[model samples]
Every structure is written in structure tokens, then in C-alpha cells.
Target: MAEVFIGSEEVAAGRVTRHELRRWYAPVYRGVYARKDIELSLRDRAIAAWLASGRKGVVAGVAASGLHGAPWVDPDVPIELVGVRIRPQHGLVPRADRIASDEITRVGGLPVTSRVRTAFDMGRHLERTDALVRLDALMWNQKFNRADVRALGDRYPRAAGLRRLLELLPLVDGGADSPRESRIRLWLLDAGLPQPETQIPVLATSTRPVAWLDMGWRDYKVAVEYDGDHHRKDRKQYVKDIARLRMLEALGWIVIRVIAEDKPSDVIARVEEALIRRGCSVEVDDLHRFARTFAA
Candidate 1:
């Protein structure tokens, strides 16, 4: 039987030979050589290398997302790494910031760029959306609030996503169960639609004083919703969705439905049209790419 994890003995004894290693199927990271069933993209390789190198690194930026269980972040994504104090001889240092005694820690047994120390290490170094997504996911899913992210950022003012996160973090709601909510919110924002409070109380005289709607517009009595495929396939959910829509209508709320393809633009147009008919005369303009910087 063979062991899954490799150690220094294998490296020294030549037990890790090219001929023997090639027979295995998992994707191998070059140089530092970590393997898992999933393919390691460039960013993955870099961070993995840094991690395997004897407690010398902590992965940050979009690349650290895999550890946090974010859906999918590009593996080659360039982020920052900070390690134990050493000389310039260890060239794996990407964005090297020499840390004083107070700034760094070994979180969960791995040498990590401290949550506060990350800004000085990697915050200002990523793309706008990538940076924002990481911040949002960390706060919402990881349960960090803007203040925690900031106090950490305050220690390292030049971090990658700090200022942008401070501005946008208020918008990240931990309650969203899927990416659909994010896409819908972003589309509506771009279209100049009034920001609808999500999971809001839809109130009217009824058996129940108030009920939650996925997305709601107050003045216009209109609601926008995303029906994930599970709702269609699950018989109980299908029935419940129909009943909910009918209930909202009876309760004086108009519901507009949205799906995946409705993304990028059509979602914006449909929402705008529905809102216009509701008596808000906001101009409907074409949704065009501004700079086309990053892929959603």
C-alpha cells in the first residue's frame, strides 16, 4: 500500500521518481508538488506551493477561497503570501511585507497571513469583483462583519480589498442561499432599478400579518424573484411556489420571475419593464459592458 501524503523522506530517498509518480492520476502542482483529484490551476499551484513549504506561507486573495469553500475561483489568480521572518533568499515571496512581532500568526496550524495582517500583504492587489467577492463571501459566509474586516484593514491600510469592501460590505447579506440573489441584485443595480429589500415583509390585511418575499419593491407593490431549478423539480416546492405567488398577488403584490439566462441584460430589461408598468417612469436604456474587466 502507498501513502497519500508525501514527506521529506520520499524526496530524499528518490522514492518520488518521475516514472512512479506519472502513473497516478490526480493533478500535480509543479515544483512544490501537491496533488488532489481536482485540477490545480496556476493560483492553486502558487498557494499550494507556499503552503507545503514548511509553514512559511499563508494564502490570501481569491486563491485562498478554496479553503473557505467558495464555489469556484480561478486557480491561477495571483494573490499575496506572508511568511515567517527570513532573508530575501527565499524567493517565493510574492508581495513581501516584513512583519513585526505583533502582525502575524499561525492560524489552524498553518502559517497564515493574519486576518488583520492580510491588507499589508495582499488586499490592494486583486481585481475589483474578485476582491469584492472574496470580501463578501468572507463576511457573509465566514460571518465577519464590516467592522471586523476594517479593524483588520486599519492595521494594514494598503490591503487589497479593504476600502472597496468597506464601501460594498454593507450590501453583502449572509442570508442569500445561492449566487442567483447576487446576480439578480447586481443586474437590477446596473439597470438603475430601485434597490428592493430582499427577503422582505409583504404586509396586507390577512390571516398572517406579514410574509417574507424573496425580493420586494414597496411603493410599486411589485416583487422580483429567482426560482432555482430545485423548485421546478421538487414537487412540494413547485406547489409551494405557485401558492406563494398567488398569495402575494391576492395580497396586492405583483411578482416578476427570473432565471439563469435572464442574466447580464435580459434580466435588467424585464425588471425595468415591469417596474415601468407599475407607474415608476424610469428610463429603460440598453445595458452595455463598462470596461468588461472581469467575468462573473
Candidate 2:
């Protein structure tokens, strides 16, 4: 990808006039510009924000998470920067807070929060569901160790969101593959179900593993999977998913599948039914609490 150059650089090169810059380039930042045809991706926006900071800021929050290889962040999510000392723009959030040098790193020549710092920052600053989704994506994509985040938390003893970060630290599971998967796991736990293991390998008689369940109870041979739209839209993925579910069913495993429209209550009911069919005793009162929790 061609780098989005600053307007000053183009002016210095004498390749463009003020009118040309105004007409041909789209202003991504106050003074930074990109080719009008270029799609403003997450990376592009981050670069624009860095340029707007005079190249002296560290990307943080969801923007930094995307730079660290997390896949769930939206491309248009505000470009957040720390140590920038700049006024916030329409799509830029500049924080004038102190960020230790150890918490910053470089990715694709742009300054960003270190992987652990990004995870910790998101966990502390975002709402519970959003924070878990970002943290889960970071862990899944980068294989980041949870211990690093815990240790980093010690450095920011009085951070604004420290309490929430500490609360989510124990719940961060690297095994989840997507944001929805993480949300489903949280819902299950809040519903008082036994914590299901994620990305578990389903092995047949042969040494090789046949498939992996999104989340499951090994003891009861029950599995739960959240199927997003892509699983149905992508022809090959849809076929493979069908074959995989059939194999698991043939192997005596009960699979509970969730989709975008599935309500939390419906999901809990389906999983509870599966658990009962597997000969597990599920408490009716606990199930009622699950419904209440969802209602809340």
C-alpha cells in the first residue's frame, strides 16, 4: 500500500498548488491528505492522525488494537491518540495523558500502543461487552499472553478504568476466535452455565483432530457455536460447516448454533435443553436467573 503523504510534503516537492490540493486530495486530517480514490482504511486513518499530531503521538484504544492485528475494530472508529497534546478532530480523539515509553511501539512505521498496553487500555476504558470483544480479538490475533496485561495494569495504579480492567482480566480467554464468540461465552457464564472451553479439538479414533468446537463441555459432549453471516454467504465455508456439524452429531455430540437474530434468552434455552439431553441436571432456578440477567 502506498503511504498517505502529508500535504506539506507535496507542497515542498512543488508538485501541487493550493487549489490542486484542495480539489484533488481528500483531507483525512487537518493538514494531511490522501489520494481521492484511495480508500480510507483503519491503517490509513491512523497514519493521518499521526501526521496531524506532527508525527509525535502514539495510537491507542481501538485504533491501536487494529494496528496490533485485532480484526474486529471498525475502520471508521475514531482514531485515538495518546501523548498527542492536540485538540480532537471530527474523527480523531487525542489524549494528552502520560504514556510511558515502554507502553508504545511502532507498527508499519506508525507509533501505536504496545500489544499489552492496547489490550489493557481497551479493557479499562470501554464498556464491558465492547472491552471483552476487543481484548478477545487482540488475544486471538496476536496470541498475546494474559499475564502481560496483568503486569502492565500495575504500572497504571490510579488509571481511570482500573477497576473494570481488573474485573475483566480474569475473563480474558485467548481461545475465542471472534467478538460474537466472546459475547456468547459471557452470556453463557452470566446465565450460570458451566464455563465452556473454547476452540476444543474433536479427535476421532485416528491421531489427527477432525474438527474444533467453538465452545463445548467435554464431560457432556455438548458444543455451542455462533455462526455469523459469512458462514452462510461463503459457499465453501457453509459446506464445510455442514459437514463438520454432521460429523460431530454422528460422534454423539449435541451442537447449539447461534446467529445474528437469535435472542439471548432463546440461546440460553437451547443450550439448557442440550445440556439436559446430555444427562446433565440443570437447575430451573438458575435458568430463571439467566433470564433475569438478560432482561437486566
**Predicted model with the maximum lDDT:** 2
lDDT of 2 by residue, 1-296 (tens): 24576887788888777788888888888888888977788998998898899989899999998888888788999988998699888999987567888888999888899998888888888998889888888888877777888887677687888788888877788888888899888887767677789998999999788988899899999999989999999999999999988999999899998997888878887898899888888655666594546643
Write down the lDDT of every candidate, Cα atoms only: 0.56, 0.85
List runs of model 1 lying over 4 Å from the truth. 1-8, 11-27, 31-48, 63-80, 84-107, 113-126, 151-166, 201-211, 218-220, 233-236, 273-296
Error of 1 at 105 (Å): 5.8
Candidate 1 total steric clashes: 8
Off by over 4 Å in 2: 1-3, 233-243, 276-291
CA displacement after TM-score superposition, residue 270 of candidate 2 (Å): 2.0
